[model samples]
Structures are given as structure tokens and as C-alpha cells.
Target: MNLDREVIKALAPTGVLRASINLGNPILANTSKSTGEPEGVSIDLARAFAQHLGVDVELVVFDAAGRSVQAVASEQADIGFFAIDPVRGAEIAFSAAYVLIEGSYLVREESPLLHNDEVDRDGCLVAVGKGSAYDLFLTRELKHAHIVRAPTSPTVVQTFLEQELDVAAGVKQQLESDCRKHAGLRLLPGRFMVIRQAMGVPKTRGAGAARALHAFVEEMKDSGSVADALQRHSIEGASVAPNEA
Candidate 1:
């Protein structure tokens, strides 16, 4: 059967949502190195959601995760796809999480930090994305480490590449993706935090909109569509958790 027309119409005019881009993982960004267009997991998921509603998609790109959420809060876009944190949930309505993630640190393979818990010892420079969950975790847990906040994940990666920091922390997927792209970078074993990634809708959009979108996501999960999408995109370490709604 055809999906709801109203939902499709709501998305049709511009057919795009503003998304945060990570240059480290071109696959997750849905980027075509040749065409300069989005092509990865987020793009596929967002496009499928739009297509189910019978609409095309337009992808607006933002360089930082913080700005991605801000785009939705500012009504610069309809929704955002990223990791959902309790703090961000308080500011924006979140759909049921479609992916599970863990936090980890990326460091040079030869760095002493790779072998010691003392990596977080006093005066060690750790790079993290500003306003990101990793930054939040560092503030609370890595008290001895001198945290250096980068505005974006790519920048954090760049800083670490430049040997300017002892560690760069972020989602495990992102860290692994970086490791594959850059030699001599390795991810630490233990996770700092477990995360669930979801779509974010603006708070000002009202409860009904949030409910509708949440229901749509729930339906996708229940029907195994979300799992299929994850597999289709070859996303590793992602699974849909049980949803109350």
C-alpha cells in the first residue's frame, strides 16, 4: 500500500533534512567521492523514510554534530540524524534509537597512551568534539586529562593526526572508521559510554508531530525494516533495541 500522503507532502518541497557530516566516514555520510553527494547509512535511512512517505530527499550538510542539532532547534531543518543523549533529548524530541554505539578513544598506535591507564593522567591533552557526548563524558570522568574541545569530529581527527593530542574520543564506529583511513591510529578497548542513535525533531513542533514520527520509527523497528536497512548499509555494531512505543 502507498504510505501516508500528508507525510510525503510535508517533506516534498525541499525534500531534504540538514545532516551532520563526518569526513572521516564517507560511507556513513552517503558521500560520493566522485559526485560530492551523500550516499551512506544516514542518507539511506533518511531517504527510505522519505520514500516511504512518497517524497524525494534533499540533504543539507553541517560539519559539526552540535550544529546539526542546532539546525533542528533553530528550525533550519525538519529533523536531524545523530546519536541521542539525555541532554539533547530534553531539548529536542527523539525517535526510537535505530543504532547502538559505544564511546571509545582513538590514539596513535605507538603512543604511550595506548598502553597505559595513565594516559588520562594530569596534563595529558585529549581532543573531543565540543558539546558532544564525548566531551561531556570527559568532563565527568577524565578529570586528570586536559581536554581540548574540537568543534567537529574531523577536526579532532586532524588534531590527533597532527600529534597535537594524546587522545581523541568519540563513537566507536567513527573511531574505527578513522583507524581504517589513517595508519598508526588505534581505538582503546573499553567504552566510556554506551549510546543510541536516533532522529531528532524540534521541540517547538508540538507533541503530536513527535508522536507521529516516533510511531513511524517504532513501526519500522517492529517490522524489521530498520534491521534490513542497517544490513543494507553494511553498518557494523548497530542494532535496534526494544522500543516501549
Candidate 2:
């Protein structure tokens, strides 16, 4: 496929395509047990995008979603995989979502909370990853319940358990994996939100770069590349998003 030089230059201004990879979201990315390299759907997509541009891909890894977003927003990285949110949109130009992941709350089995709504009442303390999609959304939407921020999305459960917080909020799969390890932790029935996972570049990258990324996202989704990547990584509890509506 012929590529646009200006778009490629805008996206890979430093001579190589630098993609921010967040390992906090297990369904999107994780460390390879053997090679210790980042691997997951997001990494796969990033490599594919850089390959399409005829550029070598470099993974700028972060253990938290906020750090990853900040990397892209600060122009430290060329692109990033992120959950699309209004708060992050100020500095990031996000493509239409290529995948959808469920955001859920986890509570101790003995806890009284059974529904997502019940966690919002007074005296309830929810643990969330600092600057995560759940934290940003809850900060804007929640009126009563208090929020306790963990250092990263992957540590929400540990924070919740250690602090005895009322609930843990994060990716459903992460919570599920934590529940299996810790026991006595149960996810609230259903999901509180559908996270729109997408590729993004700094808004300063220009409209051409943004449109190119957006079109690439739509193509990845429509062509089943995103779905195939999920399957190849054995990722469950997430689905490829439909074309931008």
C-alpha cells in the first residue's frame, strides 16, 4: 500500500514510530513471559501501523494508562493505544474505537454491593487506577461515593484489598484474573461502562495524521485484523468495535 509521506512524517517525526504501550490493561497489553517484551492486541496494532508506514516500531512502555496517555499527549511518543475519553481528548486526537472492553466493579464477596448503582451511595469507597478511564468517568459522573486512586490500573485490586475499600473499578478481565488469584472477590453483575479502546496521536500531529490513524483504525476493525489479534493473544471479555458510527 502506497503511504503518504506527510502523514508518515507527522506520525513518525523522530525517524521511528514510537508507540506507547500500557501494560496495566491486560486485555490490551502484557509482558511476554518468555521474552519480556510487551505483547497484546495494542502492541500488535501498533506494530502493524508502523509496518504500514515502512517505519520501525519502538515500544515506549508504561505500567499505567495515565502515563501512556501522557506520553502521547506530551508528544514523547508518536502514537498510543488508549480508552477514548473527553478529558484525554484535550491533547490527544483519537481515532474511532477499534475495540470495546467492559469496565466493571469488584467487591468482596461479603460486601453488600451487588449492582453498579449501589456502589455510588454514601460511605462507599471505590478504588480506581489513577487517571484511568474509570477514574475520569467516575470523577465526572459520580456524585456521592468517594474515589480512592491506586497507583495503576493493575494494582486496583491490591489497593482495594489492602485498604479495605468498598469496591475496585477496572477492566473486567483484570478484575477476573485478580479474583482468581485472591479469592473472595466478586465482580458486580454486568458492566458499568463500555471502554472505547482506540489509537491516538497528539492533536499537534495535525489533521492529516489524525485522519490517517482514524482510517487505519476503521480498516483494522472492518478487515477483522483487530478481532484476529484479540484471538491470537487469547484475550477474552473484549470485542472488536464496529466502524465509527
Candidate 3:
């Protein structure tokens, strides 16, 4: 468990590991209903990273994943947790994913879109959280349906309900929970995309830091820390991501 001093210094230049947590992605992080503080698998992973480096963890919280990415890109945060996306790769160096979450669509009970394939049609308005992995993926892939942007991923379900959108795209678990809380809502049969939840550092952090971060992730996954964190948080609908070669 020996850590390189140079890697730690580069990853946490201020003597503390400032990790950006995205509150928008429920699969990774959310406000604790009891404590109202950020808690979840991502939080655990952040703490683990800092502990391995013998540094204190300072969570830089954001309401959306995009903001977390921006924090890392701007060097405001030493590290961040995010879904691996090509658009974000320009500024952040990503480690192998430690968790895999599903992206799915939700529709009103009476909506005729019974399947994922049926969602891409003219006259259908799809609501998605702006800057979410689903939004980015759908933006590039969807050819017909118009995408309506919501403020954040956690609010996409509400946006769908409020706007009466033909479809809503977001984390599968969040959508499922929303469907349970509200009537006349239903999730599609299968997922549209698989979100690879990974750790990231600013590209300016250097190749050594990136390699160290990547190694840290591999060790966490190999040691079962990622799986344990998911279980500790009582998270469902997500599994530990496979080790990268």
C-alpha cells in the first residue's frame, strides 16, 4: 500500500485531496436523508483515495456531473468522479470505471412508447438532465426526438412530469424511484446506455499522476473496496465495473 510522494503531491498539490462529488448522479452520490451531507459509493471512494495518500478529503460538491467535470478541468478539484464520456476526456484523465450504472427512459403510463427503440420518433419530446451522460450520448445518437434539457439528472423525472414529455432519460434507479413515488409513470424494459462511473484528475496533473490514479482505481477494485462501498451504501442497480487491462 506504499504511495509515491510525487504522485500524491501532484494529485493533491494543496496538501489536501479535494474531490468533486456530483450530487446529481444518485448511483454515485446523493444527500443523505438523515445527515443531509453527501454520502454514497463515490464519497467512500474519495475518502479511500485520500486515506491512501495520507491526506484529508475535502469534497467539492456540485449539483450536476458537468459541474464536477468543470471543477477538475479548472483545477478547482484535485479529483472527481464521473461517467466516462469522450466530450469530457479533453480536459480530464479518467481511470478505469469502478462501477457500472444503467441509463434508461421513463414515460407516462399512457404513453405509447413501450420500448427503447420507439423513443426515437418525430413529435416525441425527450427530457434529459443537461450535461448528463445520457444527455450527451443521446445528443449524439438521437436523430428524431427533440431533447429537452433539465437542470440536473436527479430532476429529470420531475421535469418529465411537469413538462409532460414523451420520454425522460436518466439513471435507471432514479427513474424507478420516481415512478414509485408518482403514479402514471413507467420505465422502459431495458437500458439505453451503460454509464461507466470512473475517477478523474485534471489532465494538467501530469501523466505520472494519471497513471497513479489509474493504479489506485485498479487496487480499489481488486481489493473489493468498490463492491464493499456499494453494499455499504445499500446501492442497487449498479455493479462493480470489470478491471481494465
Report lDDT (CA) for all predictions.
0.70, 0.93, 0.91
Best by TM-score: 2
Off by over 4 Å in 2: none
Extract clashing residue pairs from model 3: none
Error (Å) of candidate 3 at residue 63 is 1.3
Q: What TM-score quantifies how close candidate 1 is to the native fold?
A: 0.81
TM-score of 3: 0.97
Tens digit of per-residue lDDT, candidate 2, span 1-245? 46689889999998899999999999999999999889999999999999889999999999999999999999999999999999999999999999899999999999988899898898889999999999999999789999999999999999999998999999999999999999788999999999999999999989999999998888888888999999999999898888884
Lowest-sum lDDT 10-residue window in model 2? 1-10
Between candidates 2 and 3, which one is better according to TM-score? 2
Off by over 4 Å in 1: 1-28, 52-56, 114-120
Candidate 3 weakest lDDT stretch, 10 residues: 1-10
The CA lDDT at 16 in model 3 is: 98
Measured against the true structure, the TM-scores of the candidates, in listed sequence, are 0.81, 0.98, 0.97
Clash statistics: count for each candidate? 6, 0, 0
